[model samples]
Target: MVKVKKIIFLALGFPNAEENTIIWTDLVHEFHLQGHDILVVAPASNKTDTGLRLEAGVKVLRVATYKLFDVGPVLKGLANIMLPYQYKNALKINNIKLDFDLILIPTPPITLGKTANWLKRKTKAKLYLILRDIFPQNAVDLKMISQGGLIHRYFRKKELKLYRISDKIGCMSQANIDYIKTHNPKIEAAKLHLLPNWENLPKFEDLGNIDDIKAKYGLTNKFVVIFGGNIGRPQKMENIIELAKNCTEIKDLVFLIIGKGTEFKKLKDNVTSLKLFNVVLEKKIPKKDYYNLLRAADVGLISLSEEFTIPNFPSKVLSYFGSKKPVLASIDLQTDFGQMLEETNSGFWAEAGNIPLLKEKLMLLYKDGDLRSKLGANGYKYMAENLLPEHAYNIICKNV
Candidate 1:
């Protein structure tokens, strides 16, 4: 029999938020199904006070904190600094005490190191740090923060503390693992493990007909290229605008962008100013509707800022695979997602900000229905064999 363990999860995004159906969602659900007790401590959406709620048998404690994304840098920084303290105070006020077997925390703010350290000390829990975003370095890469500056130094300190406290560190890919090891030479190699993002397999009955949904979205007869999920700074939306501009004369080719973030309005304004008839920008839709759009589209578009040295993997690719839509990823040179695309025969990839290359790839998919179908089928097969929640669950279980 498997041993039942109590796990504490610290995350900024949870169910009902923009990240409703992504990595954290699937992981929490899987843990619950495996008969593990989960306690999730997340930031409250509206207020700065803690509240307790239960969802799908997991206990979630929403701590009062400021919004991280879609906010000014100063406010976001302040919120990140306060989250650790707020989490501690909230737990105390609720009188919640448990001997947790494991404490899992994913990095973005990197402020939770102190909180995770405290919990581990109190409960003797093993700390598992999921290094999704490599903090200050990624910020520095985008010129959002300067290396060796006061802010960078402050966050770097927190990042090191977090790594030091973690008994095991799970990286999204081999590139991420190499990045941490190269940057933080003091980190022990034994602690690092590969833990890719995963999702539950989609049932065939729920996928519905692509043609029916295409008609509903008025995408019928058009070679729709859909970009869904967060439209943030890291996505480099300008590159997408360039693609739209180049493809405007191709009346049969349509670009559908569905998502919201700090860059949404900027991207919308650019598209309008350019008078790109082939491009359409819409706010994030309901999950079911989003999936329908995914199926309706002929190609899924994934973009990352070319400035990034870190290999950032977008979980949006999983959605494309789930919907059996071929992906056309524009990625940074450091990322190996392009290689993954090649290995799986899942579609095509071009260097981000290369508008000409993007346009060429888009046209290739538009002209060949057989190529699109073959690539989409390959992606679905790859996702089923590899990127399932069960794979990630087994990895976490082995470490714990």
Candidate 2:
């Protein structure tokens, strides 16, 4: 069989966390191994030097992004929406031309489709739309966009264009494929494939010491439940705060919320004002340390809106499994993550904002070491057998 010569990937978001960075890095590595040249373009949120060189066989270009309205929700979304254009200009400034065989794009307002569309014309690359998050649908769920209005209509057109133009799609779950098929039947069934979230299992080692991190964060001997990474607008956390304030019976269960986003300030302010003793907030820790800390936790927590029930799958579930810890998910039971947890016995499940149920599950997991261990082990086994990062790349390359 003949091989593709070159590939280009564009991720129009901030690159800080290892989880996000590793996806593209691993993809580049895999394609390079298959004898393909790779190019990556990601926009930088902070003031940084522009231009680029090759690293690990893949060329990386970080474009400049302006600070408008201080990373608040309104402005933050706009910034993300504007990144492809910023990236385009960044490419022009650096005199880097991308004429490649394949292109992968992520969705938010579905504007990345525009970038892919442009690249397809220039390079005639076979496009693969990485369905990371469902866009206008998510905004509509969050009430950020009116479903029937002109704004929604505008974004919906872009969403459809993305689906129509891409040669193939990589989705997190089967439900996501069904969602696209239901919404847009024009996409060929053969082109849709499952590309689940994966863990870099070997990069993580057993860091047995938890007490040091606990003491540093004032969480010594506490039954910690961690919700780490990206404390953003989509996370409706007020209900979680109310749980900490009201569910005084589960006092030993300490809640840790780590990571930075637009919601951090308001979340911290509310916790301070209420004087919640058990809930602690902190910035995102270094990657290796964070994974180590996750292993030490009694449970990992994730929340997804009911509106996101169909197409969205939180990667945190896979990360929680990678840490060999059980998940306490506040999400729709109808979705893949919930189904996985229930079927594999990997974690507890509760509806988003269902404080009473969340509290109950948290207490049960904290008290029963055997049950939590069994659940955690189940998830670990699943991830080890199927969901490593290298495995995801193999699947993507094989399909492509």
Candidate 3:
């Protein structure tokens, strides 16, 4: 008989409702059915207020954190920096003791590696580091940190140490792998695995009519350009606001901005102060409502600042594809996101921060009904065949 492996996944956060829960939940369930026991540890970020809701035979352990202003990079960094000690204490408080066969941790603050490292030392478990963000390099790329400064040097050392300690590494984008190889040639090619972002299509069902939803928000019969998720620096949504302002004369066009971030209030304030007619700003919605809103949207607006190139793939693209809504992608004209949108014929891409180009593309997609249908349908087919949860699980299982 094959021996069943015990698995533990550690991440600072997991989508308790809509984010990546659809994808991760399925994978955990499948692993359980395959006879492996799974445990997940994540920080509770407003999603699990009523304690833990059980699902898929896997046990989740979540701890509450302060959802203050610095939640994304700053607060997240502090939380992750303290993760090793916090996780150690959390495990102890729960009275959990285990010698796991495998441990997986996603890198962001790159501090989870310390927790993984600790678990390895304590239990002799195999550590698999999941590279969601390339860390110091991405931070530098976004001008968030100076490349040669002390902070950069510190993060660089931490990133390298994590990579060295990991028994296996899983990357979300091929560019991420290539970037790593370029920087550290000693990294064995076989140690790196490419597992791109994926979508869980079955979890979403059409909510039938969006007329009532639009009416509630005063968006009925408008060309709603829905842009959801974090409105941070990397998105640089100012130009999108400019476009919305320019298009105020057109009553049919409306921009719906949802989700929370450091930059969210700034964007909202700008629209409010300027009295921009076609803009409607909203905070993050519940998972089901968010999915329904995406389904109801006439165009999905995806924005990323021009600054980032490597390690900048947006998970929102997969969600847009799964929703079968044509996307309006704004990113570095040279990156994978732009190329993917162009190659798939699913959306129109404009140079990031180029308001005129954005306006033109938006008008084009808005006017061409047949083109929109064809593009949306094409995207759904591509997602079904390529970016489904099964594809991600297969890649992970192969690595295991």
Best by lDDT: 1
lDDT of 1 by residue, 173-224 (tens): 8888888899899999889999988987765567668788777777888888
- Model 2, 179-273: lDDT tens per residue? 87887787788778898877566355455477887777787878888888677666677767866776566657788888887678899999989
Select the stronger candidate by lDDT from 1 and 2.
1
RMSD after Cα superposition, model 1? 2.1
lDDT (CA) for every model shown? 0.86, 0.75, 0.76
> How close to the true structure is residue 86 of candidate 2, measured as C-alpha lDDT?
81
> At residue 352, what lDDT does model 2 achieve?
77
- Order of candidate numbers by TM-score, starting with the best: 1, 2, 3
